[model samples]
Target: MVSSFHVDARALALVGSHATCETEHVPETRRRVVAVVGPTAAGKTALSVALCQRIGGEVVNGDAVQLFRGMDIGSAKAEPAERAGVPHHLLDVLDVTQEANVAEFQRDARAAIDAVRSRGATPVLVGGSSLYVRAVLDPLDFPGTDPAVRARWSAELESRGPEALHAVLEERDPQAAAQILPSNGRRIVRALEVVELTGRPFTAAMPGYRSVYDDLVMIGLSVPRDVLDARIEKRVAQMWADGFVEEVRTLRAQGLERSMTASRALGYQQVLAYLRGEIGEHEAIAQTTAGTRKFARRQERMFRKDPRISWLDVDDHALVERAVALASSA
Candidate 1:
């Protein structure tokens, strides 16, 4: 019994190795790369920590929300204690005001994975953001950002509301529009700005979103929708209890704008409204839960579209065992 492998179109182009390369290349596979992806509050952190401990792998973050500092509870980021001494990369490395893109994340994550290999350990990327995970694992592209164009688009967004600008994006870059929510004004505007500046659809210019990483084992943790919804609600409660409001308050004190991605995170947005007396805390919780559920659905859809991912349930032992099996086989 042997595992067969074949080169895909991208790999054929990259390596120029289309001489009838059959599904028979597995025995000579290079190194191993594994990713753990799932929706928010679906035990990504616990599974990741267990995998890291079991496999002596270094963890790299793929979730966009995990990059911002002071976002512990809401991001469901691993606490220092909860990390169980596993070295993690790319989490809590940026301020709420800083911008992080897939291209940058890909570069950084690749370097981190290389470092882990150098240390004779496996590389495990963990997150729910399918786009970011794919950006790292596959050789996909990220559209370049033109500061000037983005500035202009942002001004338009500020004056016209995200819906109006999203309509323009829908006209120019329908694919990007479909992927990025109109409610995600920053991303919507950025996609449209890239298309306008480069005279290309944003997808065509994405340099980091498509790739052919043969050694990668991308695992996705998918919970039942109802179960995930309940988890989201419970996590929101935990987030508030863990001082998520004060975290946003500190960020606000430092002059975080609603436009910043960190400020725009699911729960933070509604909490900001509450802090500003625009809504009550109860309303903030309810709104945040709803927003998280919506985001989770989108995340699930993104992962579903990727055939490379192996879906798994979030059982404690199963998650650890699957990751271990993938890494060991790699």
Candidate 2:
């Protein structure tokens, strides 16, 4: 959670403030790094495209899953038509066999932002995950990884399972453990590794709410919890209808199960379990829906802690226009 002290007064004022129709063109000198953030299935992709069209902007992918190629349908990646021709950077850049590194993403996303700015366009960073977004926007530095130390934790995880490791994390850094799910062994192992390598609590490595960019505008989409849950169910249903299972099957053949990050993705993980005869297809879908809802709640909790975010109702009819006004005025 980002501290309230980092909130930008000018940015927060955009929450309910109105802007005239003529306020379409944001001066290049005042162009801000606009971020569209919220829980999953909250219409962030649509909002991002609308903002880009309204403000001569390009998108820089902040969602870690969207960075991988061939994982499109499950990741909810925007189709080319959905993007509406707005140039998107960092989408489909990595193979499923590779891990998604936050530090690498931070470097690549910042470069994309600079490149977009050089082209006289605002870089709209769009994603649902809080850490990935902050990695690009905030001055957060990740602790170095030790392969041997990481291996030790990984071996322990395989033997004792994620819950045991999470118990350990809870004892060492309760704050970090509370934020990460017990089922997520990869993140748990990484947090434990950080704790050991830094000789401090994992939470201690996380910085306060301080952004690297001065001209930044964060727009959050607020949805009722029930509505968001319904949306997640609908989304998971649509993914199945869109051959999500087939997509996972194809990726699995290409060594997706060996990849630490890609294999653990939301729908992919449950689907993999089903494919391996661990569960039925119906159970897979149910788990995906339930897991997505849980993840969305976590996303909302994390975003709500950031005071700089100016939130608007997801159902707002004038969302794009208002966001434009907010960005232009900021």
Candidate 3:
């Protein structure tokens, strides 16, 4: 990605000094970068579109799951009609069989942001994935992976199942084990890999409050837990009604089961379990709702720790107006 701005000694001398400029300057000529973040069903998409409409901004997707094509219904991707003519970037950049790497995503998202700004448009990064958002806007780095160690873990995962591997993680790194779900075999393996190579806990290398960019504006949508739960259940019902099962069925026929990344997505995983006769349709819907509620709680917990974000109630009537005011001030 290109630098957002260039600093020159001559310009610094004219402004007083580098220290003074760092303390009090926000160049009006610099392009704005804003992020809309929150839990699932908190109306982030609508809020982002409204912000873009007001500020002449373009949307840059920050969700990891929304990167894949043919995984739309489960990912809750923004339909073209819902985007309100705003040019959205990076919606379907990968196929279902492709694995998503955060390092690659950081590079791609930054390029998209630069492209948006090059056209004199604000880049509004919107999604619920905490790590993806941080990877774009924060100074986060992925640890190097050893192919031999990774292959060993992968073979163990294939033979013994995720639960068995999770047990191993619990013995080695309890804190990392607590954060990752037992069923998340991919993450569990990665965490163990990091522990072996770096000689440190996996959580120690995670992103903190250190941001890579200056003048970044983060707005978080806040909702009551009960209301958010109701919204998630309603959204899951709507997804099912929209033939999400059929969408997964189509992808399954095209090697979804062998696709490690796409197969582990929320709705698709549950529906796949139902299709395999591991669970019924009713059980699938119920489990999806329960899992979504849990995921929302985790999202809230994650975002609350970021001190840079300004939180607003999603139910407020003046949400858009307040967000516009915040962006204008930035």
Better of 2 and 3 by TM-score: 2
lDDT of each: 0.73, 0.84, 0.82
Error of 2 at 231 (Å): 0.6
Q: Write the per-residue lDDT of candidate 3 for residues 231-320, one digit (tens) a residue.
A: 999999999999999999999988888767779888888999999999999999998899888988988888998999999999899999
Ranking by lDDT: 2, 3, 1
Which wins on lDDT, candidate 1 or candidate 2?
Answer: 2
- For model 3 the TM-score comes to 0.89
Residue pairs with backbone atoms closer than 3 Å in model 3 (clashes): none
Positional deviation of 163 in candidate 1, in angstroms?
2.4
How far does residue 300 in candidate 2 sit from its true spot (Å)? Answer: 0.4
Per-residue alpha-carbon lDDT of model 2 for 151-218, expressed as tens digits? 99999998999899999999999999999988888999999999999888887867788789998989
- Which scores better on TM-score, 1 or 3? 3
TM-score of each: 0.85, 0.92, 0.89
Model 3: residues >4 Å from true position, as ranges?
Answer: 1-30
Candidates sorted on TM-score, descending: 2, 3, 1
Worst 10 residues of 3 by lDDT: 14-23
For candidate 3, the clash count comes to 0
